[model samples]
Target chain A: MVKLTLNVVMAERNISSQELAKAIGITPANLSILKTGKAKAIRFSTLSKICHVLECQPGDILKYVDE
Target chain B: MSKWLKIGINVLIMFLRFGIVAGYFMLIYPIIYLADAFQNHTTHAILNGSDFLRFSNNQQATLGAVKRFPSWPYALIMSVGVVLTVWATIKLLKALIKLLSNIRDQNYFSTSNELALITIIKAQVMMLLGDLLFASGNQLSQSWLLRVNTGVFSETWETCFHDVFQIIMLAAIYETYRHAMRVKAENDLTV
Candidate 1:
């Protein structure tokens, strides 16, 4: 399973979904879904955008758990 | 600016709306089925053939009395179903249109987005097919074909779609992450 640590990162950074969405140029609803790991896939550009805005690595946002 | 991201957002929104509408439908299905089943039992003597005459006489009278106000609960449920279905359908169509437009505007493309678009289209098609099956009043008890139609399509299509799309999306995401890491590494090197 693919595990996303976005919620923890966001919380640690004090970043709101709306703020992340605004910074990444995505809707807050979309950001919320991604943060919640309901998103089926993410775009590289979107990842780049988010990493740029958050100043975090991809590993900070996502992880893979082999079950 | 990336078409893939826009398409992904649209797909995510559409999926969320679909989930909500589907949840509402599942919630009301039992009520509708029970009501219809009761009406069926009363009108048809198939439930109890031996007691048919006596039950029919009483049920006929009861049904006649019930017919006067028959439209209330069923009508309300049907109306709600129609409204939710229409709302979901509209949202789905809008999302699909936006995705298509994004595809059209793409100069550099992600194969993953194309696959995601196809998956979304297939999902929508399966949804419509399920609706058609239901509208035709075909139940699982009636035919195995009806029972497995959407399931078979969804299983075969969804697995393949998810697998291929996920791989592509993951690769693109990883590539972007790597590029960012490289840039960061270079910046660190310069400093």
Candidate 2:
């Protein structure tokens, strides 16, 4: 399964969810959905914005895991 | 989905609710009257010899009062049929009103709405069956049991065709709604 490691990246970057959501111009609820791995799909623009705000590559926040 | 559309749906729901209540009362009126007439043993009650249980009266009274009185069993069956028809109609209308209310609130693409549509379909089926049973009973009693005129057969077909068409339309709407809900759920889950 494709899993999001957004919480770990946010912790390492010392960035709160509210701050990252505001920086990426997305709602906190949507950010929470992504963080909780409940999102079905993420837009390329949203991923780009998140990567830019966190100062990290997409791989840093995403991972694949077998269930 | 639009503001004006929502307002229009709201008005339609209000009108629908009123109509449902009024129609329910009108439908049950005959049942109530039959029960009262039976209770008082009034000769005013006309059964038209449609009794599934009785075949004594073969004479079809086309217009006014006949020499024979309506048996209690026939009256009971007629009352039960009327009550069932009224009950199914009320349930259908109630489900419709709930669906309309949800639409007015822009709360479409929900499980509750789907269930409501299913309920409406079920109620429609019940009503259609009840109507068919009543019509067939009348026609059969006239032709086979009482052996009177069989003119009601044509009327039965006309009514059943209309009901069948309505059921088909409702089923189509249900399928479309089900597809829309699936798409909406997928879109909602997509971040």
Candidate 3:
């Protein structure tokens, strides 16, 4: 399964969830969904925005894991 | 759903409910007459006196014709079945109306809409069971009592098949809606 490591990236960058959510122009609840791996899919544009806001590559926030 | 579409569907549901109530009254009228005449010695005269409704011999009776007087208990049971069938059909229509209203409000996949669909399926099942029980009781009563085939005993297998078909169709719709609800939830959760 594809899992998000957004928390680890945010923690390393000293960014709060609210800061990242607001920076990426998404609601905090939606960011929580991504952070908790509850999201079924992510749009390319949103991913790009998140990557830009977090100053990281897509791979830094996303990881595939065997379930 | 479009505003007009919702309005149209709601209107149709109300119309269907009205028809069910009217048909229920029609079915119950004979029972009411029979009950009223049960105390009188002229039960036969009162039943046969009506120009629009007359019971004839089994030989002269067609599918639409009423033949012979069912026992009072048989008639009562048949009336109960008709009541149940009509009640369930009306409930089913009500559920559909609720579902349509939910769709009109852009509340597709809401729990209330799912419950409404479930209610629709349950009502269809109730209708099927009520009809089948009525049919079976009619047969049993005919065999046990005066052997007079009255009331809905004359209903063909096609009617039973139609009821079963409707139940199956509603079940299919319920399943499809369930699938769609899951898809909608997944879509909603996606970022």
Candidate 4:
């Protein structure tokens, strides 16, 4: 299963979900959905914005695990 | 919106309304007639063979007088059938109408349809019992409530066959619907 480490990355970057959501131009609810691992997929542009704001690579926020 | 499905639903709604009204009257008229007979309490009430269906089983009758009967038992014996037919049709209409609206809302896999199927099956079963009641009313009454006649028995047997066939078909329909609902739920959860 594809998993997200976005919550860990956000905590390490010392950013609250609402602040990150505003900086990335998405809703806090959507950010919370992604943090909860309920998101189906994240857009590349949104990922890019998150990476830019948090100063991290995509690899830091995404991981894969065998089911 | 599928045009054909919408039209079909509309037509079905119209027919259901008509059936509801017709069924209501069929049920109500007999009760009212019996009520009138009870209120009047005529000792010498000689009813026609064809018009007075409760006394239709009487083997002996003519333009003159053959037998006079009380009001209550005769009405009670025969009205079971009219009430059963009307009640079942009304229930069927309600379930199907709910199913239609659920479909219109794009909800195919639902418990409401299941409820409809169960009601349909139970209604048929009750119809078989009603047929039996109609038949037994004549015999058990011992020519007091209703007269003894072969026509009643023959009609009971015919309706029994029809009810059994309908029950079989309804069971098949319920099984098919359960399968379809299962498949639909799987599809919905695939994402």
Which is the leading candidate under DockQ?
3
Error of 1 at A10 (Å): 0.8
Winner by lDDT between candidate 4 and candidate 1? 4
- Which regions of candidate 1 are displaced past 4 Å? B1-191
Model 4 stretches with alpha carbons more than 4 Å out: A1-67, B32-47, B51-73, B137-155
Better of 3 and 4 by TM-score: 3
TM-score of chain A of 3: 0.95
Q: lDDT: which candidate is best?
A: 2
TM-score of each: 0.28, 0.73, 0.74, 0.56
DockQ of all predictions against the true structure, Cα-based: 0.03, 0.70, 0.84, 0.07
C-alpha root-mean-square deviation, candidate 2: 5.9
Best first by TM-score, ranked: 3, 2, 4, 1
Could you give candidate 3's per-residue lDDT for residues B39-63 as a string of tens digits? 5422343234432132335433332
Q: Rank the candidates by lDDT, best first.
A: 2, 3, 4, 1
True contacts kept of each: 0.00, 0.76, 0.81, 0.00
- Tell me model 4's lDDT, rounded to 2 decimals: 0.69
Error of 1 at B140 (Å): 36
CA shift of A43, model 3, Å: 2.4
Tens digits of lDDT, candidate 4, B35-93: 65577542123232222235444454432323345446545655776577668778777
- What pairs collide in candidate 1? none
lDDT (10s digit) by residue, model 2, range B9-83: 878888878877876776664565467555854333223323223345555444333334344444454455566
